[model samples]
Target chain A: MTLVMAGAISHAPGITGREKMAPEDKKTRYYDACYRFRDHLWDQKPDALVLVSAEHFGNFFMDKMPTFCIGLADDYQGPIETEEFLNIPKTTIPGAPELARRIADVAMQEVDLGYSQEWSFDHGFMVPLAFLTPKWDLPIIPLNINCQVPPLAPLQRCHALGKALRKAIDAQPERIALIGCGGISHWPATPDSGKINEEWDRAFLEDFVANKTDRLLRYSNDEIYRDAGPGGQEVRTFITVAGAVEGHGGELWCYEAIPIFAVGCTVVNMDVAA
Target chain B: MSVYYLDKLMYQLNRDPMVQARYKEDREALLEEYRLTDEERQAVLDEDIGKLYSLGNQPQLLMHFAALVGYAWMDYIEAMRVGAEKYGEPQYQR
Candidate 1:
């Protein structure tokens, strides 16, 4: 039972230098919550982290996109683009290739998972890492879900893949923390792109904290697109995390509707060790 | 006019530094490689938010493309608003 803790969080680049654009109160609330989440991760003191996030055209393009891919590289680098705007220090983080390879192997054996030995993480992985572990010392296993492109894996499939991931994690010797990053609601480039659906975002967070994922898991991509915007598809990462922690409930650390970033940022920690 | 090509072009522009440099240096020649229609080509060249929106480019990609073309944050948002009005609401908005 080496799965020590698991959590989900939003990865808006705005979370980095929010004070530049956000109001004072909003900035304070967001940063305070971020520090709280960071503190929680430190409390866990896991030897390795399994980061689940989406690729923002930084690694895979439309030419060739995998539904689910695990990175098996010994090191990963990012904030791949938009470094200046994100204000994240440029550095490469060490990776857990041994664990990554095991996860890939388990997925292949259990669910026939797709994988890559070469993939550079984008903001989806880096932004959250910047806040959660600024030290950049934790060895990570970066897993990606194809949320940007259409014909994405259904919510059920994401859950199933997560279950497979859980099995892989259970086999590991090190204390592992699983962190799922992305989304409550946001429209990145559409006409109504910058709007955040606060009501929807809050409800989703409520359900997540309550561990009432039955409703959340049932949502179709079209329903999520209509309600939370296309970027809401990134919620699939959360769903995958929830799937990995099936039968467990978690605490909601924070939820904020930050329009400046056009995302409803949220943080939750599952009761993994219980 | 496949909306897919619009996405494809944006993907290439974002992922390939050479393509981005060429887009910045010689916009027309770089666009020639893609099978974009006249309107699409013009939209990319002009950095027309409305035309690109109407052409059905993905919002995320379109946003990054605008940034690469040197539009400031607010300016890019304004461009999308103007484009939506001029070209009709994007399907996502509807």
Candidate 2:
């Protein structure tokens, strides 16, 4: 049976420093929770990690944009100029066409979306990569979404897709893990951008950990984007992350609101029953 | 595709007066809308291809550009191997 693990931290310049763009110490200062959860991942050491994230700059350009671009590459790299373009590992993750095709088919059967067999990872996927998996040896199958632009995937659609991913993983023969990156109320423009929605945050956490997914998927894209910020839109990735967990109920891995640049540097661990 | 590359298209258009007319309008609009820092605004008006690419926004177009050039250059060779079997050989010879 394949094991899929997933999580996301919204883009808080604090996570990626504000003034100098100094990379945050994800291991300690930035994602303390991820570190704790990292132990569990280290233990599992799945042969491959399938990453799903939105493209801040890997598969977008002026004029035309794609809603979803899957990285079917031997590796990925961020633009050279940005500091977030740190040395993240390049992955040759197996893109089980049969599996990806099945997930896409299941999703399209339910939602209005497009599909592609090829794509690459961007800063949203890479910065975390620098901190999350830096070895550069592991293989990663990336799913890049069009979160920045509107007419994008709704929170419900992402949740449904995550559900589909779990179904796909179950069919796979190899052990697999998943990570969905992005979120926890943070703005990119203003210095005072990262707003901590503890009330909603806690409620979601409760619903997540209690396996009470009924309320979890009920939240709408408008509610989340309005509350989070246009950039906070990436929060839909969490729906997929939530869907990846075999069972519900998330343990508070760690939470921090580094307002210096407006991002909630929070991380949570979803315990999967062994 | 990166806007850096699109701006390159704009840069190539600087030689065309008509395209330059619209370019200036969209250029100013981009500055105001993106709330581009003075530095960003200045870089565009100054026509700095390198700085534009650095911002790294709307990168999907780069793929389009690569494809355009790829087809122009590689289509011939690729057509021989892949396309020939599918659409027959291209009659137009460079």
Candidate 3:
């Protein structure tokens, strides 16, 4: 059985390289929570961590949309600065071509799933890995979802797709854990721009961990706009995790609002029920 | 302004603290809490076109404000289109 753990967030200020944060205070609470989340994943000692996330123009463009993509490289590295991107060395771990084929086949029956041989790890995958791995032998499989485009998959579609991924992983017979990374609530424009929806953030975190997604998964873009804040757009990442963990039910591992990037960081642990 | 144009402008302005804060009273604190420099402070205050265009530290915000400006400028284009249709290009006929 695969142990699936995940989070939906912008960059937690304490973790993101964007700004400096004070230590030993509620202000640093997100960082404190991050450390605990890391310990939990490490304790699981799974054979590999399969991460699903969005890429910020790293492997795509406005010209085309690739619904699903897989990284088939021998190694992945990052946190690219203007001059250098921290590079790490590791086995690419097999891309699971058969599993990909099956998952893609299933998803296509429901929605579109694009397959790519080369996709790099962007911050969505890198940030959590930076903390979670801290240094480990297990490999990473990068799954990219197109949330930024006009023709984005519905929140419910992403969740169902994750359910497909669970079956795909089961077919592989490998010890695997899944991590969903993205957002809590963040505008990502000006540090001053995003309007953090405290009520929605708290509600989102609470509802997701409890595996109560019937309502969340149904929010159309129009409804999302009417009720959820603009930053609520990030909640799609959480929906995917809900699909992964909802079967067994998830426990809220941690939740924190880090103001640096105007992001909310949350970690969820699930012992998926068979 | 056309409703479509006004709606686009609203979306762009939505990313601005000036605009975002409009929805909530205490939004000013969120704006002030961030350590923005004096120049940025002034640029936002002035609604200076050049400063607005150049502000890239926050692409989402910068692009949003730029979009607002674009929407406003589009109104001028619309007016010109109406004039052209009425005057037939304002030709100098000998």
Candidate 4:
């Protein structure tokens, strides 16, 4: 009952100030859509926000990468060095450690999933939050999915993890808003880097808005990788949010293939049943 | 050998500003801490990104490495393409 709202947004660093250097029209389209998404999220007015995002070798490295991690600190610091690319003011966001602990406990106990308690957050969590809660007032529970490394959790597992998160949230007394921050398409470092798979991006968004959650989850990692590039693996974060809001449909708030960012930016507001 | 060591080196370079500064200051000494092979070290030193890609380095980390080595965005893409051609397709593409 505590899960009041759920949503997803693209967290391309370009969506930060980096997009301004792009073509004026592209910049306007991306910023306008982001503003609309931000306004809609602000209207939710939830007590806590649960953010699911990917780590870009920020917190963990190849030496010690966890498949998933949750922030358990009382307050979380935003990315410091990313200012050159993201240009967001460095600040700390409040953390819901108690709720985070509950979710971690549930994940560990029921699902046999081990998670790390780490506080560092990168652009994935900050970019959307910079827009959604610029003042950094809302208590946040950050959940990280391993999108950058190989042996990633399957989309099916991500959905199940979402369900487990919902169970954890249901146990909390505070009103919660879940935000999945990631992507639709675009490669970051490969030969195909900077290319947006418009066809795949539109199809994914269409399926999401039409409530084809199953279809969305059906795409294997290889399929997604081959079609949308390795960065597209981040969409598993969106799938996790969808799992948390099970049976609830979604409305596409905004979507654009911003070439400057090399990402198909998208935002969706989930319709949770009252 | 796994390409993981390359990723580890890149991660160290990306997360630690001091290491990055050191990389710019004394590339050889900083790289010594990492167990990179001679070819890997040479590729990094020469900024022969294509050679690094051929050596099984992950593109995600390579992208950051490219940025650190002063590659412009467009040039980074070109580097990856040229590397892919020279090094055969990346592991992911293969």
**Index of the highest-TM-score prediction:** 1
**lDDT tens digits by residue: candidate 2, A239-261:** 67776674756666666555543
Each candidate's DockQ score against the native complex?
Answer: 0.46, 0.04, 0.08, 0.55
| Better candidate by lDDT, 1 or 2 | 1
Instruction: Name the docking class for model 2.
Output: incorrect
Order of models, best TM-score first: 1, 4, 3, 2
Q: Which ten residues in a row have the lowest lDDT in candidate 1 chain B?
A: B85-94
- Candidate 1 stretches with Cα past 4 Å from truth are B91-94
> For model 3 chain B, where is the 10-residue window of minimal lDDT?
B1-10
Per-candidate RMSD vs. true structure? 2.0, 14.2, 13.5, 2.1
Model 4 spans with C-alpha error above 4 angstroms? A107-109
Clashing pairs in 4: none
Query: How would the candidate models be sorted by DockQ, starting from the highest?
Result: 4, 1, 3, 2
Which candidate, 1 or 3, would have the higher DockQ against the true structure? 1
lDDT of 4 by residue, B1-94 (tens): 5466777888778777888899889999888888888878888889888878778787767777887778876787787688778777756422
Query: How would the docking of model 3 be graded?
Result: incorrect
- Model 3 alpha-carbon drift over 4 Å, by segment: A3-14, A22-24, A83-111, A223-231, B1-94
Considering DockQ, which of the candidate structures 3 and 4 is the better prediction for this target?
4
Cα deviation at A272, candidate 3, in Å, is: 1.5
- Per-residue lDDT of candidate 1, residues A57-155 (tens digit): 887777788888888888887766667767787788889888888767766666666677776667788888988779899998888888987788888
Model 3 chain A is weakest, by summed lDDT over 10 consecutive residues, at A80-89
Q: Per-residue lDDT for B94 in model 3?
A: 12
Q: Is candidate 3 or candidate 4 better by lDDT?
A: 4
